[model samples]
Target: MIEDRYSTASTLYPYCRVSDQDAEPRRHPVVIVGAGPVGLALALDLGQRGTPTLVLDDHEGPGAGSKAICFAKRTLDIAHRLGAAKKMVEKGVVWNVGRVFYGGEQLFEFNLLPESGHRHPAFINLQQPYFEQYLIECIRVEQSKGTPIEIRGRNQVTALTDKGDFVALEVDTPEGTYKIEAEFVVACDGARSPTRDMMGLSFDGRVFEDNFLIADVRMEAELPTERWFWFHPTFAPNVQSTLLHKQPDDIWRIDFQLGWDIDRDKELDPSRICSRVDALLSSQTGDVPDYELHWTSIYTFQCRRMQEFRKGRIFFAGDSAHQVSPFGARGANSGVQDAENLAWKLDLVLKGLAPSALLDSYSSERTFGADENILNSSRATDFMTPKSKAATIFRDAALDLARDHAFARTIINSGRLSVPCVYDGHAHFVQDALTNGPEVTRPGAPCPDAPVEGGFLLDNLKGNFTVLAIGFDCSKLKLIDGVAVDVLCIHKPSEYLQERYLGGGKSAVYLIRPDQHVVGRWPEFSEDKIRAALLTALGKEPI
Candidate 1:
């Protein structure tokens, strides 16, 4: 087993023998290989929908260190649907404003979320371990309610065979080995996924050469909660770029960009890391290094992914399917979105409500999402580390002008923060017959949250196909297959809701997917158009 290295997160799941060890190979509806945040979140999504899911992991609980700390609003929305966002939002340090600096001068600042109607904030700085812990706790809550979610700690998959209709899995435990079969298998094992390697699939993309050192120090600092980033700050002469974020429990995250080709071990020395931290503290606020070192590591960025996410009964999700630079916080957010996209489709297929072809959309849509993230990540990496002299000259010029010019500030690439992938113009979306609706709620886009009667609109779209009737009455008996489309009729929407959903119009209706994405929207509700749209969205009819 791999060591935790420098993590103090609690071991929420421990090894336990299951009856499958002794009995013949047991068959399950679904098997997820990995119990990290991505795996656990996928299991929770499936189990919450009453689908039987088994999750296996090599380790006992969350992995080492604060890996992905920036939880975007899109991620929180997905977590809220999976019943895992309450504690996370409560314990996290929420922020929306960010300041950027270049060469010891402030280069303006920006707010991620200026308008307010959503339930969650624009972003939150929470440790990765705490995020996984909250997801496990929510899974435990579901298990108590008889949700068919089971986690097998210390159970590692040794072999997997795609047998067309099912997947045969051989797992290793402390007690020895055992065999099992699953109708479908999802690999969320991580960037170096053994599952993808076993399948002999290639994860193709670019790996950036530059490296960055991360230090998580526990201290009561006077820094604001906003994200502060610098390009060639005066405090640290050796550092090329730096990033600072305030995490919960008085722990702060600091990253210093050390250009490629350095001694990894020597740079990780206690005194070396402390010197950098001390320099920043003393230069900024005239304070010494009065903080306890919590964790330290160095990492390079890789913008890579498999060509496709599905191969027969086995599918890939999260870091297993794709890997991106940490900038923009796209890695985990996109992974969670992969789970959200795959769960509803898998649920319908497992229940025989939709044709098996519906599963293909999971791969196509998420692959598109992965490509988008990789493109952005690659651009950010290129912008930060300009290869040619000409590119460096241009970047510096832009940074110089960004101090006073607004348009120049727009060109600054300080890791564009993560945002929801709008599946706009995708073929899967039914062409909206009802014209002149809000583009934010267009087909294939993530439906924007707004104030409603109870609390928020997203709270009502957790686990089923929905017909959100705004400022109108929609009593359509929804069906593309045998699945029933639930309807939420809002006869009188609040101004926020009307502006977001209706585009200031009086009446509109929307078809929403289980993952809170818009299937289609119309000015008025019609049974025929809605039914046709369901068929198109479900892959039963050609769009």
Candidate 2:
């Protein structure tokens, strides 16, 4: 049930008309705060699982502006699962090449598509608003399919209290204060997350000393083939540079570095913005082209990550959990992954299939991934924004080397730093007894997207636990009791994923959980081993 309430008491769910004087508890399975991508993604996943979710947000409509302009392959996969990927792919620009320029020449041009099989959309450049609108429509379709997802827009949560059994929320709607009670609450609010604040979690990390200006402007001058990056040292020392990205609606996103000497307040003026853009492009391109500025914002890059991603029954997703510079497009991709990581666990807990302890994996897995993203993005930031003289010298040396040598060029443009994150640790699946296998597509790694019998493998694994039996012998593994494991036999190396993953195998059998994490693997398939691994993953002892 979708409720776009300007100010109404009656709702699809159990609604009660009450003022601040006579409000009572209204319990739901889950209550989500903030209707951003992360929160709504969580809601969509929960609703698909028939878990009643109440999503509350202050804004009535989708967000404005083009904050995050990049999306990764993994995010595209998740979007495909939610049925929104097709829309995004059709509308957004597919960016497969990123060019790194130094001085006036192209220092290194990275073809990102060769490494990532053209199977996945490399990186997508799109305005955030349209991307979100597509998602909102998908959510509506999911609602029409009979999943009860209550969206209370223009209603901001004033306060939240964890009451052990359930969470109590005080929401300030247009009518008055309304109390909402739910078994769990997920906060996907932006950096200023009130839920995280209520948990008393401190976001502790480094704040970059420099700040930059982001502006969307109409351009007149012809630019290079919509390539993503431009690292020009032409304006070094003064720290003048620009990152130009193509946006929809004939606007270009321009990010420029303003040296510490410049005043941020002064840069807000249109003339100062024009001067900055002109300075960054004048020598290489030519005179300032005709342009109209649409929007401008001054922002300092922060690499701050939260102490924890979960607090009791409340969970934190998106910018609330961690924040990083937009160098490698880690911000939105990480948030989307956060939603994906959390959705399965929350579904299991809500459905009573797994104990609440299963929810603990969200913090372990997501925070680890967050730290890695921060490290990568920070490195990209450091390379992009060379602060000190020594740092600048190092960057120039690397770029010069790239220009001269093929090895150096490959080394510099590996872009392996931007690959999808692997869940190496804190997976809560690999146990001690089952840990004697070689490190070739082991547990905690993303199950290789293989093709089986004619279609993509994950397609068959839509709703069941899949047991990827890679090792040859499978006759003895037929009688696992009370546990379900779909068997897939991989005899030789797959032509599709030969170089990317460990494909040549006969002894490896992966017990894949429904959430798609490798729960267990054995050299030889055995009914007993499979049962124990599933029990352990679900936090249930074999009976």
Candidate 3:
């Protein structure tokens, strides 16, 4: 049945034959270590760009359980570019409203999608298994179109050695062991990363002693499609907090805060889990429904990242590069962004279109992203589990004030939630000559989505460097020597477009990267200025 959800062929690719008697090793353009969302996404991006990619996973099929349920808007946008967002959006539970409570008292409720010019919603709640299934489908479609993306299961990378020009990998499979070489290696192996350990890399950051119990239950229940978070609920007095989220197929995800001194084995007992779930359910509706326990796991909070995401020909993405507290759903969302940021750069480098320095920008840009996720996740964890007596006092006082005063509601931290990180101060961005534009659509930010002629602006810019001309003719703009540019002209701009791109009342030209990040913008289109910005974005020159 699991194989039915994700096609059997989708999960298993023919294992390559590697005899120890072979004279030379088989070489690949890119080898991705893990088949999780990040690795699969990277493979899809590269494959669509005509790069041959080989994905290796030890498991025989997609993962079990609803691991990462919350996918942010920016992540969906990336999926859209990869041609995988339709099924993800359709099968996922979309929730734009969230309510935070202190005990039985409601503090405040916030709306994430207050205004909408974008095609996707603020966030979607889909099980990680389903997410991976959709991505695998996308990969298979690309492969059908002659983009070589090989996904081999039951294959494990036992050893890795950087050879400067290429990385040598020893893979252990069911049949036997084999050796393969790749121009680049992307490690998406996850938190306990073997590749990271093989490289002798260390993650540096804070780890909270607090533990959390995540339970996924399937039952028919009448509940609003919204996120509900509680601080010090009455039913679970010993627990610090609780979170409730709805998913597809009448399944619900509930997270309970278990303090530092919890008994790991004893707490994970089925009877104990049932009791905990019943207690929370009774507290809400005074009755527990007949529910099936689909999955349960306990994990500690950690906010750590590698010093650098890249080392030689071996690159790290997803959980291999960074780990964060699940409070804000930053782990998977940030990982997807990492894959998007790196795939394009790698494609260019492999095609000899840019220098190797282009890869360094991936490190700089994604490290900036990882740092932001770490900071927000750490702050949420500290608020949830106060480290010191003063912190605990402040947290309690803030909750008490939240019940009475509207201003105090801002202090509550159930979770900050995930949003795209703007690479504002990074060296890759070029500012406008007049330095005037909407703050949300400034250079280095993910291009804000707006409705254009046929579809959303993001739809047109998929997998290509774009020149967005607003109130200006882009027909005369010449392409750079090594860069292919797709020119999108807005003959009549909408209010949202005008507000986002023409806020300064000037005709503007914007250079957008293949990843849909704005490289720079100018009041008037100049061939030389745009070319210089393109070079700067590729990490070759200063603008």
lDDT of each: 0.88, 0.70, 0.86
The ten-residue window of minimal lDDT in model 3 covers 1-10
Residue-wise lDDT of candidate 1 within 169-243, one digit each (tens)? Answer: 999888899999999999999999989999899999998889999999998888778888899989988678998
Alpha carbon lDDT of residue 163, candidate 3? 90
For model 2, what is the error of residue 286's alpha carbon versus the real structure, in angstroms, after optimal superposition?
A: 5.1
Residues 1-543, model 2: lDDT tens digits: 234422321222223334432646778888888877788878887787678888888767666655777777667767776778888878787765667666657776666563433335666777766666777788888888888887876677878998999998888765677687889999998777877776678988887777788988877557654664555646443554567777665677878776556687887888878777676557647776777887788888899888888889988999999998877788878898888778877877887777799888788888888888888888877776677999888877887898878776653421233445556654467652334454435666555465545655555544346776653656534334433456666665455534323344334667776656677676667767777777777667755
lDDT per residue, candidate 3, 8-81, as tens digits? 22443445544531536788999999888999999999998989999988776666765688898899999999
- Ranked by lDDT, the better of candidates 2 and 3 is 3
RMSD after CA superposition, every candidate: 1.7, 4.9, 3.1
Which sections of candidate 2 miss by over 4 Å?
1-23, 114-118, 219-224, 233-237, 278-290, 410-417, 425-427, 431-440, 451-454, 469-494, 497-502, 506-508, 541-543
- After superposition of all CA atoms, the RMSD between model 1 and the true structure is 1.7
Preferred candidate (lDDT higher): 1 or 3: 1
Kindly indicate the candidate among 1 and 2 with the higher lDDT.
1
